[model samples]
Target: MMGKTWIAAAICAAAIFSVFPESRAQQAPASPSVDAPELAALGSYGIGVADLEFIDKGRADPLQGADVPRVADRHISVKLWYPAAAKGGGTRYRTGLPGETGSDVPFEVPGLATPGAAMAKGRFPLVILAHGYSNTPEVLSWLGENLASKGYVVLAPAFRDPPITIRTPAARAGPLTSRPLDIAFVAAEAQRRAKAGEGLLAAADGARTALIGYSMGGYGVLTAAGAPLDPGLGGATRGVLAPFVAGGPKADTLKVADVKAVVAISPASNLYGTPLWAAPGVAAIRAPTLFIVGSQDHVVGYETGVRRLFDQEVHAPRYLLTFREAAHSIALIGAPPAMRESFWDFDWFEDAVWRKDRLMAVQAHFITAFLDRNVKGEAAKSSYLDGLVPNSNDGKWPNAPTGRYAGFSPGAPASTIWKGFQPSRVSGMNFEFRPGEP
Candidate 1:
């Protein structure tokens, strides 16, 4: 009987292992040994990081837990990554698990949190990064650090959202409703601080602002860029998202005129099988936007959620980049060391069909090109975005580079290669662009 019981346990383990083959395969290599080359900034200047705390007094605690009393004022923490003249060794940044106050565990980054890193000369544009639901800002350090390295100051604000442990869709409403407001307040404060010559962000160029939001953050950026919430969406929120209902007081505070562009990654547009933004509401988003999503995303349904949002925005010039067979979480930095012990935890930072590092590399390339062209007014960069192929793999380089394609050779005839991508690196991606209807 004991032998039979042991046999059953072994069978159960085998079944579990077979079900998550990709996770097991990825976990085999120790994370410390993997090279996250994609995380490195492409610019010549070193990166520096600093934390700023802002107070939104008299604001209701949107995520006040049912078990806890409400707090009148909301305290927001913002982490800023920027270009610096002084070089320093990379350091581990503090991060917390879901719902925790401060992280005891370290999330490694390639930048120093040195206040005296010596700000590089010239005014850099501001890029505010909003993370997914229940996620800390440092998980996106890869983007923040990389953008900073490329002469852009990136600010990631930690939202007072629901804990990751919460599984119910209803529990997400308060934080969901408050996300846009959080971004608006954070951006305004960062701009104010920069203009006032306050602290580390004194060199920040607030006139040029771009928002990059992932998952729920994506929803927030779209709304903040002027996409209105459907007046009827209040029913789906169970009154928790009432403030963001169209024509409500909160909805009036959503738009930010300074935003030059937005990038939404796996945004939660249709949460819990309900539409949050109607077609007319989405059409109001006039800012130039980019959408990055997985074709097989179940969390945010691809057809009805992301693709729908992309197709309805007929007013703005938009681009949609799809990863074939990939799921949500395409823009994450890396799997946190603390999450390595479990498959579900590790998956938060990885994709089943693609390497996270490579994905980030492609993201860095296109995003750099897009933002540089749109926000920085670098008209020359437009060459990289024009004439893109429908499918990444369809773009070919017969004269493939021995190491890297180094982008197209000067004046090389247009081959099948996707704009800005090297040989063989563009597989499994679909990029499309549509200008506003005349």
Candidate 2:
């Protein structure tokens, strides 16, 4: 909530710690002006990452088949950031970190500092990131950057980024089917690159694909995989003639049989059981799913809302994350606050225990580990995913969910999961963060 001007303040207060190398306490190299993306020690998966763009103009299935195709041979552009040859000189971009952008304020970091863009030499496992409604792929860049930093090819396409020009209601109705087409287009393009020898991202091992989505995108991954996103529930038409944000399969299209796994970040499936994505078929989606929601989030009604969509109905791998003290926005990387128009003072953001970066770590760890286990076939029973381990951090807050989780240890009490009046699942979502062990 503190504007960009605070960066100077955070820096000034942060400066008391000493900037030179040697031993201010631990005796390390100079202080890093800002946290850099951790890329050196990638997980078991290989390394090197870079930016990539694939033609996502797959043809739209004009026919009624559930299969999706786009209108352009080269019209749709799906931008992909994947593990690459850590060697190429990829162009640099501004910090994708949210709030750090410094409101309409001038840049202050000085020097053309750059965060590393990932690139993999050979074919790599692929993960697709879907941004929420009215949002462009750029908004999801933080997630893309995280996974890319960890060595997975991540693709974020602008399926809903197009400008709206509504002429007729039917015209609006026509593209509703385009969302799935957009994702299929992205998948097909990644496959195409492998054939053209783009690298590991191109030659994925089997259908080693994983989808991470939020808000409407939260529904997009489900609908695209055949969950059927019915009317109003999809959140595409927020109000009148608004540009139609692309999305979904009618009902029973892809099936849980499609994606390897899914990480629904604050998905809004308020009407999961109604005519919109009927609970039965939608719940049947078999892939492992990790329903992550911020404790303060009303969007997905916490993970419980997502659980209701499948809870007893699901028969595959499933997990959940409640970023203690996190607001709904924690689920979205690089996105401006989730409920920007709440009319409430923005200070509420800083009042919570889950500071911005800490919440991001909560989101990133669970997601990356989820895919790493399901897609790359990393051993399941991962401490992070199974909760067999406690979340920990090295003073850096990326792994902390709530500020408490910032320094929690495994043997620590579950008390962290219960905040305020004791965390009663019945009372509402948990407002606790458990920093998973590194």
Candidate 3:
């Protein structure tokens, strides 16, 4: 009887293991020979980081009811990453995730930036990074630090968003109104500091600015880049968002001045049963844009959400990079150690089918190219963003000699593979570009 019971347990264990052989590792084995994408590699400059706090005085708080006597001030926290002289050490950032009991589950991430390091010489383009709802800037330190090394002043704002579990209309209203407003306020403040030659931001170029947002943040950058809001948002936010809608008294405040480029990743566009930006509203976006989303994303959706938004923005030259079979987690880093214990927490930063590091590398590569070409006016970088085979699998490198590894794709008539991408590293993706109307 004892032997039979032991045999049954062993069989059950074997069945479970067969079904989920890689569950422990959570991702496939790293490719042995595939080299990192070209633009994804760190740039020449060393990185520095600092924390800043700003207050938007006399701002209306949508979360607070009208019954509240005084208008509330909006306090924003920004994480600044910039080019700096090479310093030996790095920073380990501590942040929190939403816990079940309405508290935070703290975690830590390692970073390449040296805190309080001396700023590198030269004024660089400003890039405002807006994270997804309830997400911290530390999670996107991957992007912030990488861009800083690449000669950009990156500012990632903490929007203080409500948890995703909160389903009330009131809960939705706060983020709906605050996301874009926070982005605009931060950009304006950063630009002002740059103009005044303020500390840390002294070398920032206010004229050349780019906005990059993921998910809810994606919604923010689009709005901040001059995409008009739907009037329906007013009633949805219980009239709090009315003033910021198109043609409203505060409509102009929603947009950042002189925006050179915009990047929206898995942006939430079709919210509340309608598209967030109508065709006319999206047409108002003049800056060149890049839209990155997973073809199978279920959270903000794919076909009806980001893809639809991309299709509507006809007046802006835009590129859409689709990660086949990937999902909403494409914008963030791999799940931290604390988050890895549960599927719910892990899904926040990792796609089930794609490795987070791979996704981030691809993202960094294209984002660097796009920002360089559009914001810095580097015409040469345009080759990296355009003229690729739409479907990566269709890309051909037919004439390659058998013995040597093919490095970066030569592109065009020489090889159809994407520019700056290694041959083995270029599958499972699609890239498309459309020119803005005259």
Candidate 4:
């Protein structure tokens, strides 16, 4: 009888192991493809990375109510990437799924950044990066590291969001409030540190700052940039979010001052069958903004979600970049191989029709141009953002001389193809621009 019991246990163990092979071998997955668009290439500066922590004292604790402390300190973990002296070797980041406990997966990304490398001279623009729901900063290393190399101090804060799969509306209260508040707090702290000339951010140019967020992070950055929350949101959180609503006593606290630029990628809004921000709410955003979205994004309805928000923000000088047949997974890096073993994990980083690497590259390219034009005050970069053929497929590139690759489009009369893009590589996309009131 004991032998039979042991046999049954052995069978159960085998079944479990077979379902999750990584549990046994614990092997790292193959690195994602490195192929990138022309402008997605790394900049001249070497990259350096560091991890830091910050605490928001006496903040409301929505996750735990009467039973636990009503107000507790919020601990935020930040992964910072910045310009550094060129160094050998790269960094491999380890991360896990939203609610996964136990094993974390490791994947090496091909890059020039060296962990703990010396900082490069001179102050560079500050960029506050916020990730999506239940996501860690490590997942956004592609953007953080790439921008750092291009002469920016990039900080990505871990919001410690609840799992995306959580169905209860109350489960969202914590993130809905914490997302913007955390971004606002980090921006303020980083600027303060910059002014004081202290720590790794000493060389950061806080005055020339930009906010970039993906999905929920996009929602956070938009609100933090000045888009006020809907009054109805207060009731959803049982008045826990009342103070941060538009015109609320703490409304000012949610905004970052004089934001130079804003980037919202697949931003989440209108998730509750209603718009999170009204026309007046979004009109408050004065910074030049860029909105990127997948036209067919079912996760955050394209027409009802980001597109609606874009249309309402008529007062801001904004541009919308639409991926023809893509989906909500537009902003993340390619799924590491281990994640591909399961549909749930793989969906987090991949799109059904678009290649993740290509999506990332295109994003990096446009974001670079936008930030450079608005934040760095590079007038030359404006050409890259403006005067483009709206539909990429309609753009024309006359045949070039043999033995030479087709060059970037020069815009308008010379070539209709969007500038800085290889001829064959540009398609299935649309770009629109609207100027703010002068």
Q: Best candidate, lDDT-wise?
A: 3
lDDT of 4 by residue, 318-344 (tens): 999999999888887667667777777
All candidates' lDDT scores? 0.73, 0.48, 0.84, 0.80
TM-score, ranked from best to worst: 3, 4, 1, 2
lDDT of 3: 0.84
Segments of candidate 3 deviating more than 4 angstroms = 1-34, 66-70, 100-102, 164-166, 401-406
RMSD of each: 7.9, 10.6, 5.9, 7.9
Output the worst ten-in-a-row residue range by lDDT, candidate 4: 24-33
Q: On lDDT, who's better, 2 or 3?
A: 3
In the range 294-342, model 3's lDDT, one tens digit per residue, is: 9999889888788877888888999999999998888777776678677
The ten-residue window of minimal lDDT in model 2 covers: 105-114
Model 2, position 405: C-alpha lDDT score: 28
Candidate number of the best TM-score: 3
lDDT of 2 by residue, 284-371 (tens): 4667777777666664675466546546335655666655555566543322333233333233233255544445544555576678
Query: Using Cα atoms with residue i matched to residue i, what is each candidate's TM-score against the true structure?
Result: 0.83, 0.61, 0.90, 0.88
